[model samples]
Target: MGEAIGQTIPLGVGVALSPLPVVAVVLMLGSRRGRSNGPAFLIGWLLGLVVVGSVALLVAGALGPTDEGEPAAWVSWVKLALGVLALLLAGRTWRDRPTGGHRPELPSWMRTVDGFTAGKALGLGAGLSGVNPKNLMLTLAAGAVIAQTGIPAGEQAVALGVFVLIGALGPGVPVVGYLALGERAERMLGELQTWMVRHNAAIMTVVVLVIGAKLIGDAVAGLAA
Candidate 1:
């Protein structure tokens, strides 16, 4: 459980650093209905993660009882595939990384964010967490790590819970700050948004590469044994 949790922390951090979701939450906070929309989005985000993690755990458990007190061989292969996917994503991220102080472009839908209500915001948040390409893959990878562990179901759930909370931190901080500090959060959130846009790709490249290599090594060891 400990090793599996350790493996997922980086993945959680990577998910947190995702700029699109953070930016969306920030923009929602800047709107008139922010009080409702922000929290709703956050709730949706957490729920989406919970659903994904739960599904992964159920599937892993249903595959059959294990005698080795560890994940079956197939889980390692899934991890290996995930690792290769991560490396490919990292390469793409590196190539597309912003340069010369330029920031990445925001999604077109972001232009209409202020017009969104709580329900739409909730759906958006859920989609970003469970459907967005980068976040979806990372969350699934985290789920895979948790599912592969030989820990009890309760412990697996706890590990996944921790991953979701940590993963949501990047998007949650701004909302919390805005609620706590009121007017003072704007400048901070803005600066954070800018910084995230500038550094997101670089951070993802390093994180994905390291996690990818680690997954490959773990898979090799598992298969060899």
Candidate 2:
């Protein structure tokens, strides 16, 4: 059980930390109004990630395995694939030069901001993953990992619920990590508007392929060991 649980963590992280959620946060938060709504946006961004992990738990629990093989090869592949994906994504993001992809850019005007509502911002932030294909694929992969572990659906659900809350923290650490950045950073991301349109598509595609390779790579390495 411990080994199974241990194995699931990377899968969960892979699913949780993909660029879709991060991009959504960056995109929506990059909006002109997003700077003013920083607090709300942050809250919502986190809630949205929670929704994603929750989905993973629910799906994994729902599709409980009836028969299974300890496919160490597959698992190792998954790890390698995930790692490659991360590197690919990092490369793309770096290529696009978003500075801080997970964090948004704030505009000069919104720098010294006024009152902002957390509720509305949260609403938009929650929608970050709504149309994101990356989020869907990542979440499904995680669900597969969870269901394959032989844990009861109920327990898997619980674990995923917890993971989402924790997972969001990984990408969102900056929101809390740097206070001076605040809304300004979120708005400035808009500077990438032109760049995102021109380069983000290819970057995103590379991220997907790379992560898949990483997953497969990890699986193979484990099998070798």
Candidate 3:
């Protein structure tokens, strides 16, 4: 469990520290129906993550038994694949970066989010957490790591639950603050949103590159050991 957690921390952080989701949630908090939609969005977001992670874990478990002592070769291969995907995604993110000192445009749907029903908000949350390429891959990678760790099923579930909670924290903090501090958080969240919009690409570039290398390196080390 400890090993799994260590390996998954970055993936969790990557999912949690994503700026756009937080920005969108914060924007929702400013809407008239924020009270219902914000929490609903959060629940939906967490459910999406849990669903992906759980599926990966289940699949990994179903792959049959392996040598008890040595790590499975497929685990390393999976990590390598995930690493390559991350690098490719990093390149794409770098390319999509807004040139010059301009904010990246928010999606057209975001403009209308303020009026969204709870159902729409929930759908949006699911789309961002489950369907977004970056988050989906990270969650899968994290799940694969846990599943491959040779831990008991019960422990694996605990680790996965922890991963989901940590990954949700980044997007969850704003909602907590909004509920607690009310309007006071608006200005801070707004500033954060602006900075995130401006630097999101660059930030993701570093994150994906570093974590990608780590995954590849860890996989290679496990295979060699």
| Candidate 2: Cα lDDT at 163 | 48
Q: Rank the candidates by lDDT, best first.
A: 3, 1, 2
Models ranked on TM-score: 3, 1, 2
Candidate 2 residue-wise lDDT, 108-185, digit = tens: 433333333556556755665423445545554555566557676577666555545554653364344334576656
Q: Could you tell me how far off, in angstroms, the CA of residue 196 lies in candidate 2 after the best superposition?
A: 9.1
- Please give the lDDT score at residue 126 for candidate 3: 80
Tens-place lDDT per residue, model 3, 24-93, is: 8988988999888988889889999999999989887777337774457887888888888888999998
Candidate 2 deviation (Cα RMSD): 7.6
Q: Give lDDT for model 2.
A: 0.52
Positional deviation of residue 113's Cα in model 3 after best superposition, in angstroms: 0.5
Model 3: CA > 4 A from native: none
For TM-score, candidate 1 versus 2, the one ahead is: 1
Q: Candidate 1, overall lDDT?
A: 0.81
By TM-score, is 2 or 3 better? 3
TM-score: model 3 vs. ground truth = 0.95
List RMSD in Å for every model shown: 1.9, 7.6, 1.3
Q: Worst ten-residue run, lDDT, model 3? A: 63-72
Q: Please count the clashing residue pairs in each candidate, in the order shown.
A: 0, 36, 0
In candidate 1, stretches whose alpha carbon ends up further than 4 angstroms from where it belongs are 1-4
